[model samples]
Target: MTGEEFQNRLNAAFVFEGANYGRVHLIHGTQDAYSQEVLQFSGHLALSDAFKAVFLEAVELMNTYCRPRVKAPLSEHYPQFLARLANAFHTLCGAECAAIRGYPRPAFTTLRNVFDDVVLVSASLQKVTDFYKIEGIDPNGKFDPAAAKKARKDEEFKVRKLMTGSDSGLSADVTSELSKLNDLFDFEVHGGRLSLTDAMAFMKGTGPLHVLPKFVPQTFAVFMNRFTEVGWAVHRLVPAIQPPGVSMPKEWADRWTLVDESFEIAVRSLSNELGMKVGDAYAEFIKVKFPFNAGAVFPL
Candidate 1:
């Protein structure tokens, strides 16, 4: 199906799903809204039908990625798990694009934030899964050994290189999760050195890579900014709609309590993850030293 057709189907399916159950459960509706926003934001370029298909595929991708293993159960901490998945997609996309484009180390703060987000989500999921297993939930069908191993290996490789600075030709200042990959390997895959233009073209194509549209750092940031806004809105609306005795997770509860105090910390964390100081000097450097010509692309 075309992109538009896919998107329409996705929208319809989600709307139906939401309408059918959302009115009864504030959590369900809020979650649905979050998912729908992600779908819409990521697939904005596609035709509606195609976008829906792609969105479904993305969800399936998440399921596949998080499928349970023989030894461990899948986590029931839905929000944290979803957040991690989102951050992972974003990090991978940015790294791939930078590798392809030969961009001089995009900020590391975003990538670090992605890593931290994933770690938190993964930990929360693990906790939930463990809790369920101990409580006699069906534990056999929740873990995927191979996928888990791959994820661990990928993360290990990334973290090691980022922390140790082993790769040559990578900038010494490139310390963020996003910049770390540059040191580990040359962006020579898919024939010649990968460029951002080529990466964008490849991402706009098909399959798992289709998610690349959502993962690429520049676009991903825009999407994330939107997600944060939506999340804040949902958080605000939740109290009004929530039924009595619906207990929120401790982490979320804590976040709400310290939301004001955490804003600056969050900004700093993001800055470190992207590897750029959020000061005016850096902004000036980009404007004066690295002025973009007509065709030159600025990275996210």
Candidate 2:
């Protein structure tokens, strides 16, 4: 092959068709930039669809509860806190979509972004820092790095400090989880030697490097688990914004219980019966495991 032909072939998008013949198909001369094939591969998975449904339901709950109509005469800080919480939920959904599409790196990075967004919401609630103050700008409406630098110097504004410090309002379990997740996601996002080597290892024996989406059930499972946890974290913020001793309305709370129970069953089913079809048996597992009647009213 000529030099141009060799380079063109080298840069083409290739996917391993099967392990039996070790065939790599170059479906197109250019890259599969949109990950169309990847999505197609993922679309057939029952567990993946369940994960998507769970996340969508969580986002729906957020839309239902985290709004002005839920509580009239909102507190002064409620708007800012809810805004940051909304951002976290938005990024959480983005991470879910990225993972569902078989883009693990983007999903990992965006999960870290979700954590940071949640931290900021917590910080605002704890009164460690004001959102507007940190976002302050010059009169011209342009960024002021100097002022930003000063804001960064504040001990209260440091992520680790805000998460772990005595004044941080987060519970011990939450503080520890956030701290651990931050490190884990940061390591993956930085794409260091270890991270790159690990990625390559995952693709080993699968022909050439996979530039397109891969249908890795294990990785998708992990994403679903993490998204479920993060969704709960987002939900917790709603009650945090309420008045002392105030909780979400019983109707909304009951609805959330249903979603949470369904999600847990889905995750457990995926774990116990990995590679099993998500059909009647899957629905049966949920019914059997949930300990509630389908026709019964929501449990008090």
Candidate 3:
């Protein structure tokens, strides 16, 4: 859609109870306000409709907190990776849509793909020292071949360094946030859940031979959690206006713990039942795995 159209859909619309010094929009998620405000949008809304309210609020918050705050373009920092980032966001929107439609398999699968988007953002930050080396980007952005190559083939060790805060001048909070996401992203991308076939079979109930719920709302929540987590990395990487004041939303593991429980049962049981070789599973979804630690990747 055109920039004007996007603006029309997303511009400063009051949502989930007007944000206030006295109002309570941030916490409790304002179930009543969610409908009264967000559902006010009619017609075929942008795919980002669900999170637009919070995202715009985040922009304002970042501007308020970012130091050396500049209204310069985001592309200034990510000139070499703009197109890929857009593609990732677009596909992530699709995943969000799938999640809404109750397709857990695609929701989780596509979430894994977008994790690469997170790596792309992190890697570009590593490659560029200046915040505004590249010029602005339009809605239709150009491809950077180098970025495309590195995003696909960059070593896990290097990516982990940036993500885990072993490199890059990132805050402990952001790196800590990223480490949690990256390890989980690795889990999905590398078949820690189940293969697409297995997923389809499990859904159909023809293979697993057990009745399971067709969909889980938490599946969508899991995808959204990653979206915001990566978005957190991107927001910090951009030139500062200020640091965030509102709490970063971080509730994926609660839902995912349940999903993983089912995953462990179905995947492990099926692997044993079918006599499936570990080699086959690894070969299907292999990506290099990086070592993560208690302090860096997970914390008690």
Candidate 4:
């Protein structure tokens, strides 16, 4: 087929999906569909926006304070950690974009990447000695292939081992739960049978299968809540990883405080609206997510 023929055929397919299967095509109906979805769940939409703001603020704090001006011997590895943290924020931005555009399956898949990023960060922080070990450099600036291979292997952060090993400093119970969570993320990322079925726009009995994106309010709510929880856990670890002799600025600290307080309020309100019976809902969420350091707060 010619290029124009292929394009016309694809557009016809999209139009058919919208008319028959209730699918929102990317180029045509997604914006109107998303606008209606947001209106239908304004409270959850606001909470998603709040989570994005918090994640953005956390990235700004890292760019301003955690990123180094001059590379020092003691801070040589700061860039490695900061890069992963920044990447987590960027990936989350992508997830939010996908979600708001009515592509929740990919949004959920993007979140798995963010989860691994945070896990890697947590393991690095816990096993600081392994992370800070410096390698010998050649004075002649010659690279040794054997030494480089060894260095790469040594720097590997195996998620399963790190989360479950004794060196990770996590309790056995927490590690067990994390292992299950890891498996769940893997299933989502790998497109398991259940994941595929859930992505289809089905109702109580029977319906046409939708190939294009459609808004799933319950899935959106669940993913948004998980995103906020992960953001909260990662942000709380930032102060502990600040450069030696450097503290978080008072203005940024205060901003974090304001955001944290507001987030707690929003989380509690949302949880109650969603019929959660847990009292002190935000604190409970923190405890469940990061039981190893449930009491920790951001900005030190």
Candidate 5:
């Protein structure tokens, strides 16, 4: 769909939310706000209507197929639920789209990597919780049941400390870096959830590739490489904004670096193998337009 037509559709979709009309109108007026440049620079090539349809369908299928396999309650298994959805999205899309034949392997690999990361992180957190349960040591080095109850409130803190030694004064820097790396694979933060119409607008920005019947591995590779770079950049920059004295465990730090290095190598190899030019195009576009939307575009 043409940009203008897509914008109208989006505006219409937001009509039910009376408060969103003015913002929607402004978004409609600013072509650049919903332009191809935004999509390319943001490494958001997967934001197409076709992708969304396939993704939602896959999510439904996963809910039907994988939900039963999960032993935990739905709330507790949210991350697994999402991992399954992502897996289903990749599997169904790959099967339905002929173009995926060329890119299927890498694309499938990427999805698997993301799924594994989620599972790994979740498992790590669970292990830490189990360790605390068995050892009965809280962050303050105390063993009070009341404190333990309160500690559960900030579950992420416990997990973060265990994974990165946030309390030990060793793994702070490394933890920060790993956090940045994690963002690269996180879609909710990077791709901000959208209403169906807005999602369509974002997808339209991907141009003709979205409508294709097959996967474009090269395009996916280009987008992922940029996304990964942005994550690293955020990690490097955060220390400047907030002086770092946090500590991480040596083993965890080394393993984190190894993972980061592997991703870096994979990104470079994929770029060369796919002959992706999206990164260059994105760089050029950002050089010219970043100044105008500096606040909206860049955040560490």
Candidate 6:
């Protein structure tokens, strides 16, 4: 199923499956209680459609990568990465849908979680790729038992340092984008900053004279930003791990192009909304559209 179609299935599953339903329950028709409860997530129909369309393609590529015919399986840690990535996608889709339904406070939380998942993609990169590791840690020279164990525990699944430093696993632009995202929401992620209640308070603003967020395009951008970066990494990592006798698939080539296009479309949308110019490198990769039939994209 396409990402959009999958989203619809998830929504339907909820009504039939009850609490076991794993999809966003977005209602249709005119502005009603369910939709009015949340803000409309995006008014940029073309951009929104583009994001979902490419995300579907990325999902297909991931499934293909998981079942390789020639090489050994992807890294042992890859399943963890996929689990988180899929969850992030689910959260992202849910958050955007929620915003369209009018519940943006939860979308804030979801956006923060999405950033954490993107960071995971960076940490898992070295594990999944075919690159050799030269251990910088002194395996034999260690002294303290408890301290060593604690240190090892602490070091698990950490890629922020490597990403920010010299490993260069992620492109410099992606690294920079993540750094900015981290800085922007550091307190929020740590539970020091805004809560859904606090966001509601902001919306409620000063005893009935309320202020509202630019919910539509802004919420869409938040969702797109998180998915595009990590999606690009996970999508691109497949080809980077080909074994010696294994040939790359034409599917990957097409998927790679689609992934890049998706990422570019997202970045360009951000730029346009922010009134900034698209960078030259990404400018070259820009496409007019990643077309899809919206009517058929989701069967609900």
Q: Which candidate is the best by lDDT?
A: 4
User: In model 3, what lDDT does residue 203 have?
Assistant: 75
Cα lDDT tens digits for candidate 2, 175-223: 5544555566667778643236446755676455656565564555455
Number of the candidate with higher TM-score, 1 or 5? 5
Instruction: List pairs with backbone clashes in candidate 3.
Output: 65-241, 65-242, 65-243, 66-241, 66-242, 67-241
For residues 1-300, write the lDDT of model 6, one tens digit per residue.
799998988666666436444233322332245354333434333444554565565456445753465455445444554565567667767766765555444555667665544444444443422111111233457566666566544453344355342363445664555456656466455663534434564566744322333334454445445445434443333343333344334664564565456555666665666654333222322121111111111100
Against the reference, the lDDT scores of all candidates come to: 0.35, 0.51, 0.41, 0.57, 0.37, 0.46
Query: Which 10 consecutive positions of candidate 5 have the poorest summed lDDT?
Result: 291-300
Ranking by lDDT: 4, 2, 6, 3, 5, 1
List per-candidate RMSD values in Å: 23.7, 11.1, 16.0, 6.8, 18.2, 11.9
lDDT computed for candidate 6: 0.46
**In model 1, which runs have C-alpha deviations exceeding 4 angstroms?**
1-58, 61-76, 107-109, 128-300
lDDT of 6 at 296: 12
Give a tens-digit lDDT track for model 1, residues 1-300.
Answer: 999998777666655344643434554444344344344444222222232233334355334532321233323443433444545554545643342232212322334444433333322222322222222334455666665566555554543343223542233443333233333223332333433443565567743332121224554343343233222222222221111233333443344434322322333444566654432222222222222221121111
Q: Which scores greater on TM-score, model 1 or model 4?
A: 4
lDDT by residue for model 5 (1-300), tens = 999998988777777447547554544444333243234433223322323443344344345643455453333333433443345444434422321233322343354343333323333323434323323345448578776766554664554454434552333444454444455445433353211222364567853332212323454443345444333222221111111132222443343344334434444453466665433332332222121110121111
What is the Cα-based lDDT of residue 277 in candidate 5?
41
Which residue runs does candidate 3 get wrong by more than 4 Å?
1-79, 122-156, 168-180, 192-213, 231-300
| Candidate 1 lDDT trough over 10 residues, lowest sum | 291-300
Candidate 4 structure quality by residue, lDDT tens digits, 26-71: 4457656775675776755665566566556656665686555424
lDDT of 6 at 101: 50
lDDT of 3: 0.41
Scored by TM-score, the top model is: 4
Better by TM-score, candidate 6 or 1: 6
Query: Any runs in candidate 4 off by more than 4 Å, and if so which?
Result: 1-26, 39-74, 128-176, 199-205, 261-300
